[model samples]
Target: MGIKSFLASRKNQNKITTHMPLKVSDYMSTKLITFKTDDKIETVIDSLIKYRISGGPVVNSKHELIGIISEGDCIKQLSDSRYHNLPMTNNTVEACMIKNVETIDGNMNIFDAANKFLESKRRRFPIVENGKLVGQISQKDILKAALALKGHDWK
Candidate 1:
């Protein structure tokens, strides 16, 4: 082989495969199931069961995320007498939702998102874009992404 051709082939063989940087937007579930602040606990519970989700984002009339509610929060009500009777129906979602919620930006790196979920022990997180609810990310989502990258499909 000619020297130039040999050098060209060697250069091609030395090329390295680079992984594209992962963005939260790329991995986050866009089919966001959300609840409103004024929604009833029973309504939230029904949606949770219907969607088979552990938690979801709470939004206002403007579609801005106000807080979040999870199955854990609903379970807490089962033990409280105030939430046991018919009068409890008057309570709103805002009363039961966790206002101090952890959020992740859609532009953040997936690794950073995984680290945050691990450090905070949060299972579900709302994805925000310009302070508005765009989607959601969960531990399951991250795990699915990781598995896909590893060439394994999660069962």
Candidate 2:
């Protein structure tokens, strides 16, 4: 049988679930470094560097996620400032954040989340529950889960 057909034939079998599929909550990082919409880009940059992260979720006054800010976003702001011959210090995260963000629920399967990572340009996904930020999932998290599934110690 062809590889595709063989895999397709086994799709309905429970062979893959020898162990339960990893859930987002199982692998997502709960200790997140988040930012506020009105926070200064400079401060956000410093925090991102301090936290050793590429980006973070941006929240509102009520701690509801409103956008996402990343090193790429920060770079865009700097590029624009240089282009316009203006100081980069005056900008806020809100000015450069990606307002329409894609979020995942904590209960989502790691396979589904992996598909999202493969299909999009985002390096991470913000985990939300009841419209509140709960955790963050990244490619690294998925890799860890995959390694664990294969009976390998990722840590």
Candidate 3:
């Protein structure tokens, strides 16, 4: 290959791997809104609605994440209540939360984490470090980070 072409090709390869090292901490939302496992589902719903969020992490008394509760999960209870005349107000978050959750390490690069998001049905992922919930990253966060890269390689 010509010297100029080889150098241009190498630069393009560097561009791909350069952003691969960008950490999730750089884009994750550290000011996370969360819920407690024992918190009443009604309260959970209220907080979610108030914050205009679809869901949040469910933590325990020691502030350790246990699960995630979302509006989609609540819909089942609401539907049961309407069909069977059962009360939904008495439920706890633990009863409706998704106990099996996928979490990401806070230090994971944005590119890798974005791939995880793309492969899963989840809209958001909890960022954990040392088994403690540190922050949250959503699809929007990845999009925002990607958009920030647009002007970087511009002429």
TM-score of each: 0.81, 0.81, 0.82
Task: Residues 1-155, candidate 2: write the lDDT tens digits.
Answer: 64566666777674453555579899999888889877999998899889899999998777788999999999999899999898876689888999999998889899999998999967999988887888999999999889888773335
Q: What TM-score does structure 2 among the candidates reach? A: 0.81
> How large is the C-alpha RMSD of every model relative to the true structure?
4.3, 7.5, 4.9
In model 1, what lDDT does residue 120 have?
Answer: 91
The per-residue C-alpha lDDT of model 3 at residue 21 equals 28
Off by over 4 Å in 3: 1-21
Least lDDT summed over 10 consecutive residues: which range in candidate 1? 81-90
Ranking by lDDT: 2, 3, 1
Error of 3 at 17 (Å): 14
Error of 1 at 76 (Å): 1.5
lDDT of 1 by residue, 81-130 (tens): 36555456545678888998878888888888999998999898888878
Candidate 1: pairs in clash: none
